[model samples]
Target: MTTWKDFLVSASTDAEAQFDRLKNRLFSRLDAKKPYKIVYYRGFGSPTAVWITGRVLRERDLSTPSDNDTFWQNLLATYQRFESDEVPGVTVRVDAFGKSNTAVTDKEGYFEMTINPPDNLPPGRAWFPVRYSLDAIVQPTGEPVIKDGYLMISPLYSQFGIISDIDDTVLVTGATSLLQTARLTFLGNAYTRLPFAGVAAFYRALQSGPVTTLFNPIYFVSSSPWNLYDLLIDFFRIQGIPKGPILLRDLSFSPAILSSQSHHTHKLAMIRKVLDVNPQLPFVLIGDSGQQDPEIYTQVVRENPGRIRAIYIRDVSEDRRDEDVRELIRTAEAFDVPMLLVPDTVEAAEHAASLGLIDPDTIPEIRADRRADKE
Candidate 1:
């Protein structure tokens, strides 16, 4: 009884419905299968809900990008980035010191809760442990599952701390170059990635230095989004960078600011937060010459006065930016904070050695690692 046009319309309607179903599935993928397993980011600050957060995702939806991934694998990784799954609207309970706090996940399947510690908490240990338990969920196939996760609390006690950038300063990310940066970001996974030569040993020496002692806290404050948290953690583990809180930019991907997400604002906000949290401890500012490190560190010195002991910026872009760096270096003379623009990791080590931030013997260790990496 239907005409050809009606048949075509019915078919078209069915296809649209199918597409809509697919889109909705992508949004609720983790929720439909399992209660999201919590992925915790290290939290700083204390006394108040020093703010703890982690993303929940289904196990199978997680992608570990490798530099050696084939074309298809890379494509899958790209999908993982754009179409990643998150747990949503579920309540999570966090337990610490016999007290519990509750929070509900966002549409992105992320949750945050600040468990209060006792009034007279001991600082003898660097880390205190907390337990997380998620509510049970039913999968489409009628399977039930429950997830448990743990978090560590870093207590503040160091004389001086180090806030370093990760992209170019610690890891050899091609951030200054758009094409190269995109290539490295999209194609490279944590395992396939590499660290800047001699950085690990240099940082370890600083951590174990006479100035700050063995447990000096190091905060890797990066402008990169939080989505790469696990990959960055693996990179640090492989490179032997000392364990510390890694504060990353929020990839909230908020529709309002996607067109103008300011990296400067994010990094600056984090640096200020860290400084504010540990008012008694001075910090060393470590960044690179690539983007805004020199400028930002200059501002920090100007604003905080004597709080920053030194600024060490690795010279990753010497050819075109020597004059720019020299200008920043010269300008730093106006402030009490010393700034060192080093040509190589060894040079930075030497400066730190001279300043007593690290041992003099660290210079030789850095040289050896540099030689080994070259070979």
Candidate 2:
């Protein structure tokens, strides 16, 4: 049952080992420092359980620690190889919701553990109080990183789920423009990074309805690598956006078969993984016309018919593709899926309201957020 990802992990582990040996031979003086940091990604699960993923690595950038964790610097560092070495063969323990799961980190220092509770927990957004610590016997230090991991369990009987792209649809990554994308990447911090106008309010309305308890799951799927996971989490909070699982690719510049897949392939796999996790929950796919979102979402609509509740495509005003997007619109129309080639967040929100997907009153919140951006 070996998978392509597993093969890639194995290959990457070998390459990392070779790099470490070479480093040790040249810089033996640097070996005195102990490894004591962990990079954990928030995970999601159902009402009765949750799953968490993380990598155990030493704090390599201890010289320039920031008040905000300096994720922007780490994000920039991801472009280089061997930024942080993985502590493999480490015994990691994860405890949450009165349950515990133990697993060993692979050669990549990555571990995933799922914890199931005794009963179904409360609906809406909830954190299971996750705590992880490396086994002292194998660790160089006893320090443990404490962070709250989020798991959004959609109301068992709620409406459709949402899996949207982040680059241009939610935040202005300028992904379609090379110069703009590089500038934003190197120059912008998470706090300064901008979300598209009204996107936050629209997403919030979708999560918490007019009655204010609707908890349909909303997921942010992006081509951005895992290095920016924390930054995106901060971006969601500062912008008043509804919180959900952020699934990102592992854009590790390594020799791996899994890395060979196009960005769209990675996204499609993640979307399908979400669908498999929530079998009964139909989805509303959202993305932009910036890149392959239109085409990728079209394939989803075709492959998984009737399960798609709707589709929303935010048009890139800079590179507005009428003919290309129109072709996608026609494709969605043929399948009877409600699709929109929207110019902005306000228009998308209004269209969703008209379709009874959200309350008509949600438009103001979206507009207010847009206005705040201008101010």
Candidate 3:
């Protein structure tokens, strides 16, 4: 049991320490002439923890803050909710890298932080956590005020990339069933998302590896609608998935366009955009076998050859016949790119780590099912 003063005092102290740690971390990693911005997000629900996630942008060449045209802004409005007794406030602690700083949300549930580049701040990736408390009090129920959560800010480059898929890949909204899909698209909210088990653990494992590594440039290229971006982000945060750019398709596209266009093509286009900007680095691709991932990956392997080092496909429906699976196997063999088919992301990651793609001692086990061939 904790009192109001106990909550306030503890929260304030923690917030201050978190702020200072973030400020110092950023200052140590930024250059004086480079500008950057931080975006904060808060989740709403019963005793839900609020999180701040943002990327830092820096100019390649030394540019004054006044001359720098690019700055950070929210793609969607920040969200907040007040129970009968919750209160919110935000404070911007420092400003460098253009609009880099800290801010607390007001009663309306909005907050912004800006910063200017510091001369001593080095030129590399940097991150900081925004910690705070929510204050609430219940009358007869005796519920206390002030819940605690965090906001995370780290530097990101436009050249960084990510590749993901729809259906059973990112969100488990039932891509195979039209009725289920309609329900998910129409009535579903963030809570409706059912992330494949072990996805969060796998993502965190990948992020924990070496800096500026091969898979650093990441993105989520899904056939799912852009409308679900917020939901997906919240899902990833709750599940502890690494944050990066997310590319979503238009759910309202023309029938001809939607039918004629392969999701693989859209994903390839996104990958091309990332490669066009950063031509030197390879990419990481993640997808599922519920639809046309095998066909798409086959084409990608043929076109790019060695651009993709590894490909992981979740085996959801198990609809691919023996011949089709064999063909995909041959395609992967031709390029020397390791293509994995796993029951879920966990098993896929286990294969990846075993192949030295990630560093984790304990790997998830794949359940073996013994069945005789009838034919």
Candidate 4:
């Protein structure tokens, strides 16, 4: 059942991996030896299972962001992120929940693994910390690289989960416009980039849910490349947005990349993975209408009936796209999932409040934050 497109994609992936191998070998001989590090990404799961992901790369001496950073400095830092030297074919290990599991980095130096949840984890606690280290040694070896990665664990008694998009939904990337997107991607750092007005308060409210202690886990599923993962994490930290596992796509170049299905494929796969891990959790999906969020979310609702409590699609597209989103809203409604096209975070918060998904008292805080962001 393999088509020509599939063949091309496989061929391109193999070719890219081969090229990376050769490049890594050549660089190792020419450049000075550098220490390797394991950059553990945040993970999430329920009480029975947990998922973790991270990358292994040569430690680069990039400049950290500062409040008074210059444009050139930000641009330089952004450039360095994309130019990261990945250490492929390296084994990674995670020791958590009284279990040990190992995985190897692929051509892109990324590794993902699923491990069992802690045996005696408390019921009310949300975050679980685990130790991860390099299982196998590779290149300029020094001391062993061991780091701690935290996973967001949802309690069985918690409220609905929040699955959100990053670029347009939370951060203002101007994703619909290529020029603006490129400008921000290249010239912007964590300090320079801006989140949408009231996004912080609204997301916090969703994380808090109806009950203050519910602590519903929020997962950020974005179509952005993994190279910008650190940058996005910095943005979340700075904007006071709730922190959770950020599932992002690999920056791969293939014949399939030319097709629009790539975005849908990546986003859908991540969302489904999240839903699968937390089987008992119902979710509220939040995204923007700039691209394929509406369509993809509709598919999610259709496939996982009753699992999605509601959906909020922020209006970031032209008037023409309005009808498309409205159609999706109707489609989602057929499954009893309330999908709303919101003008801003306030409206979405209002809708969530009415649904009892979030605290009604948080509306005033969202409005205040919106005004402050505008000013």
Candidate 5:
């Protein structure tokens, strides 16, 4: 049953794709002699197969920012991020565990593939390096470009997994308001962008779980564009957030902007994929009430049933949205998953400790960190 809205979205999506193809063709012709690089996003997998995503783009002069960087420098870096020179139709080869796979970049210069190893990987949580090499024909004037991308393989049996959102959930992007979001994004560097109070401590505790060595995997699934990948990675490092596979969406000119429901489609699919790959592992879902996270996470609980351990939504919106999420909490409770809308990380930490998801002794550390972050 395709509604009128669906038909309109489909037609607009096609038009946007065609426009992107034309634009990419022109850029490819104009930037033939430019230096290029392969930018890899962190990937995740189990013992049998690995999933990876990356992009090939003409290199820009964006450098690491210092604390004293001028406003102009931040603005320029932001511009370079959005002014991407994507290289389409280039062949990329990925090799790991004595096996190899190949994929071609799409018009948006992005490539994704899943490769199964010849044999099962050793059972444990660790990072594997996947070597990526570009076809020489694309860069005929110089040596072939090669880079290593990392894939995190979680243990077959663990306490649980965590899937979280980025923008307003952990990092403060003021996502509910376009003007504030733009102000923060355009003028702020990794050092300047702020994460919610005590997010680092809370996420670290979750990663370590009740036992410090558990190494429960954490995944970030966000609706943010792929262009901000490097900035987000740097921000995570600066804030001491646990690292894992970051699932982001392409910044294509799609009809997604016109429909609120389309924003969470990518996020939901990515969360489901993570759950599907780790069938034996239950998960904790985390997001915020600023957008459609409550609605999306409720759907996840309904679909996965026993697979979801709990849900924690950070409260960042108004009373109306709070009530909306409260109703969603009731809806999720029907599936036996405890869903809480917390005003801060402390509340979530308390509930998680009560549930034995994290160690109770870590509560003091969380409080100290939260207080220090406010300074």
Candidate 6:
């Protein structure tokens, strides 16, 4: 009699067109008794998507192939619709890979694959490489999708983390100017957002690290509207940022009251909450110089100075000649935390590695990749 593991091996294949059919057939053979959780992440205008299906292993006699076979089948079925959503007039193909399997996304930008690594597969790490592409189209709204035509499925770590901003930081479009700030506060989502370049890369790199590392937990605290919570999550997912709790400003509180607090008072309050909940983990804070990052980080250093090992600030314009920059320098000086000013993410990563915050061995490789792209 063929074992369940043998059936799973036989079921693994590379035909993207047959992914759905194969998944369905395999799942139908399962008993459907095991509980599974379906997790998914998608990015806008990018051909990247992530999904994981797994059932919690309880102490049960799974020695029989039938017992475990059904579980695998059910897990595979859950991932079959990876790219089935229709993006009008555009066809997307998702390329998916497992240790022993490969597949592609359908016209609707979906793909499915089964991951059944050998039992000896390292217990602490799980990675999947996925890629896809689609024709570029300008939506009626005039938003253009740039197709770079590069397909790469990197080793996505099973563990991930995130640290984000608020106000114009993660929500809305303006953070530095007073007029735009008023608009973002009063109108909310109507203000729109222009995410910083290389933000997606930063998040993906953090996600690719080992789950048990000090920086694996992703964290975001912003003064933006809490109503945009789901939208932000989807944005990060589609962009390949790891998923984590987003701490947002409670609009229910009076704006006047909030203003009375320090510039970073609200963000600092939220950061404290994050530390309270996750006491031992270190965090990489992502923010812009326009608003309260420097101020909040200053306070964070004073309070739990050890928790934040790296802070990345995008150097947008500010009255640095004035007291703002001086104050930030003073705060960082007090903590002995090296504050780096960078035009983009690549520079930030380089600085971090140089400071021994991240692995130094990886910097040359990342720099080379940057050069290749530019050439």
Q: Which candidate, 1 or 4, would have the higher TM-score against the true structure?
A: 4
Least accurate stretch of 10 residues (summed lDDT) in model 4?
A: 135-144
Using lDDT as the measure, the top candidate is 4
Per-residue lDDT of model 6, residues 221-283, tens digit only? 776644344446545554445555565543322333234463467677867765554454555
Question: What TM-score does structure 1 among the candidates reach?
Answer: 0.82
Q: Stretches of candidate 4 above 4 Å error?
A: 1-18, 136-141
Error of 4 at 130 (Å): 1.4
Off by over 4 Å in 6: 1-162, 166-172, 178-193, 210-215, 253-258, 319-323, 359-375
lDDT of 1 at 299: 77
Model 4 per-residue lDDT tens digits across residues 254-369 = 65554668888989999999999889999999999999999999999999988999999999999999998999999999999999999899998999999998889999999999
Question: Using TM-score as the measure, which candidate wins?
Answer: 4
* Model 3, span 237-322: residue lDDT tens: 76456776565553332332244465666766755654454444455567877777777777777877667767888776645453
Which scores higher on TM-score, 3 or 6? 3
Q: After superposition, how far is residue 342 of candidate 4 from its true place, in Å?
A: 1.0
lDDT of 5 by residue, 162-244 (tens): 99999999899999999999999999999999989989999999988997678889999998888898999999998899998
Q: Compared with the true structure, what per-residue lDDT tens digits does model 2 show for residues 1-375?
A: 988877877778777668766864554366546545667776776665455788776555333323364655645543422356566777777777676678888766788876666565664444556777776633345445444554555567667788999999988888989999877766565677888888888888877654556777788898887767766777788888887888876645354424545687889998887787777788888898888888888898898888887888988845447688888889988998888888788887887787677888778878998788767
Q: Put the candidates in TM-score order, highest first.
A: 4, 5, 2, 1, 3, 6
CA deviation > 4 Å runs, candidate 3: 1-122, 126-162, 210-215, 253-256, 320-322, 362-375
The window of 10 residues in a row where model 3 has the poorest summed lDDT is 78-87
Error of 2 at 324 (Å): 2.3
Q: Which stretches of candidate 2 lie over 4 Å from their true place?
A: 1-17, 20-31, 60-82, 123-125, 137-141, 144-148, 254-260, 317-320
- Which whole-number lDDT from 0 to 100 does residue 121 have in model 1? 66
Q: Which stretches of candidate 1 lie over 4 Å from their true place?
A: 1-22, 25-31, 46-49, 59-75, 113-115, 135-157, 211-213, 252-261, 318-320
Per-model TM values vs. the true structure: 0.82, 0.83, 0.54, 0.94, 0.92, 0.49
Note the residue pairs that clash in candidate 2.
none
- Please state the error at residue 356 of candidate 5 in Å: 0.9
